[model samples]
Target: MASDPFDRPNRNSSSFILVGVPSLETSPICLGILFCSGYIITLVGNGGVLLVIGLDNSLRDPVHCFLGMLAVIDVVMVTTIVPKMLSVFWLNSTQISYMACFVQMFLVHSTTSEESGVLLAMAVDRYVAICHPLRYQAILNRQTIAQIGLAIVVRALLFMDPLTGMVTKLPYCHSHVVPHSYCEHMAIAKLACANPRPSGLYSVAGSSLIVGMDMAFIAVSYGMILKTVLGKKSCWKAFSTCGCHICVILLFYVPGIVSIYAQQFGSGISVHAQVLLADLYLTLPTVLNPIVYSMRTKQIRQAVLKMLFSRKVHA
Candidate 1:
């Protein structure tokens, strides 16, 4: 039988569970409405991104292909965490079964890692196209893109597997009430009775290695791309083409970096603030990615319009 973490006795029982954090105070009606709205928006936006990329032959190139995979990853990630989280909030239940909690932890971490990998792959794609235009098609062919996507999934699975196992193995002698909204690694680790130094060390080390290497590669790639773009006669046009990608990169990376540091260093930020920021990181990309592609990429916009109008005509 699985032990209940909350039932465990501790000296600082009051502090074991977070105090002063505002409870979910909204009426059930409001909670239901908000949950439905969030789910619908995320689903439609991510679904549209996948549909547009898949159906439009012109958008099947290396860059859009990567973007499409990102859309899929976002959809999977949100589906895994947000709905259940909304349930917890609406029901006002801080308790999650040990197995369910670990499963959620695994899915969230895996998808997040995969998303980071996908972003890094997109950066490499941009680097190849802008910095080495002549070799772009040859290097980033269809098979190569598929291979990169596979690599992202494989890497995420491998990286998160051991961490999930480590987390599930820890004795939960503290309170089960997670400090934050989700089953995040840091939050869960704090509840463990076992010495979490190893887990913390592993998390920081692994995250730093992966994020650092990826960021370095992206930085080098962008540096070369900038040099190449500046050398071009139509530098403005070159910049315009890469602008959307740059926007997406910044949007995805900046919040992630902020959240990681805030969570790690025990910044004095309130639990509510951290939860809101974490939700934003999970959601914004789902909403923004499709909008950015539709507005910025002429091919994607035309494809979306054609699909919408065709559906209307058929109806």
Candidate 2:
């Protein structure tokens, strides 16, 4: 009877059970509260940013437009995982259909790539604003923003197609229980019946090709900005312009970098710790980007305040 309980769900199972925080599975109430709170906060914070940006024409500048794009990405990125996570805790419903799991995996990675590319685009925008102040208008017009958005979509598609195809080919002969709150690529890959090494290698290669390249570009852009800002006034202005972005970049990248090293290179860490790190890697950026921008950027703060006050007045 015990053996039967542990038997394979089936080699051809049409879905996988996401074992959300198995170590804390006994305390579903606590986990449910925590994840649901994070979900609400993310939706409200990001949604507010988008609303304020839309309402304020003064914020229709290229920078704010890019910020609006980022807000949308954050909302999508968080939506792909958090709601399901909440379900795991609240309803104890963790069974994600096979195709739906892949779609979630695809959306998570694709949106992550888009966010990284968007950050790089924002860095370029700042570089132009600081280094070529006079030509900023001509260079980063509405047409250029549209082109950048289109390019981001194309980049995400190009990267995800091969990776998703490879993952789709994987045979899941082992347990169908994924030991995480979500259907992340690496987590799902770990369950495959065949060798998972190729999937890991492909992920590393994709990261190098996408995130690594974007980081290099951002570094180069910042380096040039530093050189161009020669004097005190210029230095202050340049740094001021980049302050919010730098915080966002660090918040977005640092967790994943640390977690990767900790998981693959570091020794003797528990699985729960690794899962927590992964959660932070994705969740922190989505939750914090809007908060960081609203707090650090005066124009955004003022716009949000104005919108709030206007609503209150109408009420």
Candidate 3:
């Protein structure tokens, strides 16, 4: 009679090994350089946005408020994953303790949820600004934005707690090798000796709900924004208002959705390609958001220029 492979004795599964893009293992230095460069840009770009918006009272409007919140979330998302990834890429430090692995999983997923929530809130802000220009101030004032931000954080943690908790409770008697850069939930779940379908289903359902609802709302918001703008004589100007946010929305959702599903079901795709997509999905948006906003939104562009000019004078 055949026996269960999972029941067989094996080496220590106390800590999981993260094999970050196995194809790139031989070129660790190149991968290290790429991630290091991206991490630096993400930090400087998002940090500059936060700093500029904080110091400039003129940039304290609701749109900029949401942008600042997004900057904070981007910083959290990248910081949670990038340093560990650098260690794996550069120093060959790939083992992550069980507790530490779950912590990273929680942070990565929770921050992704928070970013989605912030994007939804920003979509609403755009809707109000374009569709109800007169009521924009009363609709998304300081207090309301604060409440929304609080809700975003609370909802993200509350939703992610159960998912991570379930994965943590799983008996990981199987191989402790994770095939991705960070402690991605499903990647870890698949390593458990027990059936991982329940956790996988929950993760898929939760992710689908968050992404679906947020994308639907954003689409509807833009639809209404488009309708309102087209009726006006200054349609071009109105559309220009949403240009940066639209670009940001595309950057956030498109790659993310593709990478997630590819990891889950794209058997035809190579694991290395899947890992690369996931890594880029986690990172590219953070590096691009500030640059996109700076180029598209006049107010932010001016504020950033002003900050740089003043710094030059001080120098």
Candidate 4:
């Protein structure tokens, strides 16, 4: 007989069982296959971008710098959860140590916040390139890019640490069976015997403050870029340069916001649906961002082709 997770002793040291998507319970093999495939695509796609960027000197610029950062974050974001998710599906190994759960929770949330910051930075890069083309080099120099990257990391760590800390301090005597695949903040928090309101409130507030501010800044940056390029003869060219970034932004944010809101307020939403949405929110962008960039950006396409052909010749 499959033992009930609740049958385990209620101790802070007890491992949490990640139930994964209850709707997909009967299809664990299928789900595992899907996750495995997505993880491969994410690794190959993002890893290809990073490789091409490293090999091609001409690809080094402010925009590519941010793309590289985004790819790194995407790889981390998916890797943090997908392996454990696969274990749950394939081996029925749903148990996650208490410390490991908190670590996963922190990494997932921090990487997400950092990705948002990178997107905002990319938006500013586009705005500068389009609106002040001459000053673009001056504004987004190597030093400035480094500083921006540092700021993004620092901000995520600062905000997410407190949220994770708040959750860790909560007493978890209620239940340790997390409904979703991996350790999401609220899912873990809801397991606590004590009131999780403070942690929940901090999560909502912190996410809103960071994501909302990043979205607002990105919007304003794009607005100015549009205003500057509206009547110019080079308008089409400028728009083309930003098209890939815009698509990447939408891919990352749209599903994410939907999943987050649906999880938070959609009372009637099924756990299966919510879990699927969350999985998509995390995995989709990582898999698609490199493909979109390769298709849309001529330089990346050319560089990638060049790298592949060179390797082929060597082989």
lDDT, candidate 4, 87-108, per-residue tens: 9999989899999999999999
lDDT of 3 at 144: 99
* Candidate lDDT values, in order: 0.73, 0.82, 0.84, 0.85
Candidate closest to the true structure, highest lDDT: 4
* Top candidate, metric TM-score: 4
lDDT of 3 by residue, 1-315 (tens): 987533444466688888888677788888888988999999999888888888889988988988888888889899999899999988889889999999999998898899899889988987898779899899898899999999999989888999987999999766787888999888888888888888887887788889999999988998898898796787887676567667777777776776677666657778788778778778988888777654456888898889899999999
Q: Least lDDT summed over 10 consecutive residues: which range in candidate 1?
A: 13-22
**lDDT, candidate 1, 1-315, per-residue tens:** 977655555544433232112354444456546656776887898798788888877787887888788788888888877666666556555556667777877887788788888878877887788778899999999889888888988988888888887877888765666766567788888778788767767777777777778878877877677778796786877676567666766676666666666777778876667666666676677667666644566677788899999999999
The ten-residue window of minimal lDDT in model 3 covers 4-13
- Clash totals for all candidate models: 0, 0, 0, 0
Model 2: runs farther than 4 Å from truth?
A: 4-9, 234-244, 258-267
Instruction: Give me candidate 2's TM-score against the actual structure.
Output: 0.90
Tell me the lDDT of model 2 at 16.
89
Stretches off by above 4 angstroms in model 3 are: 1-11, 231-233, 237-244
Clashes of 2: 0
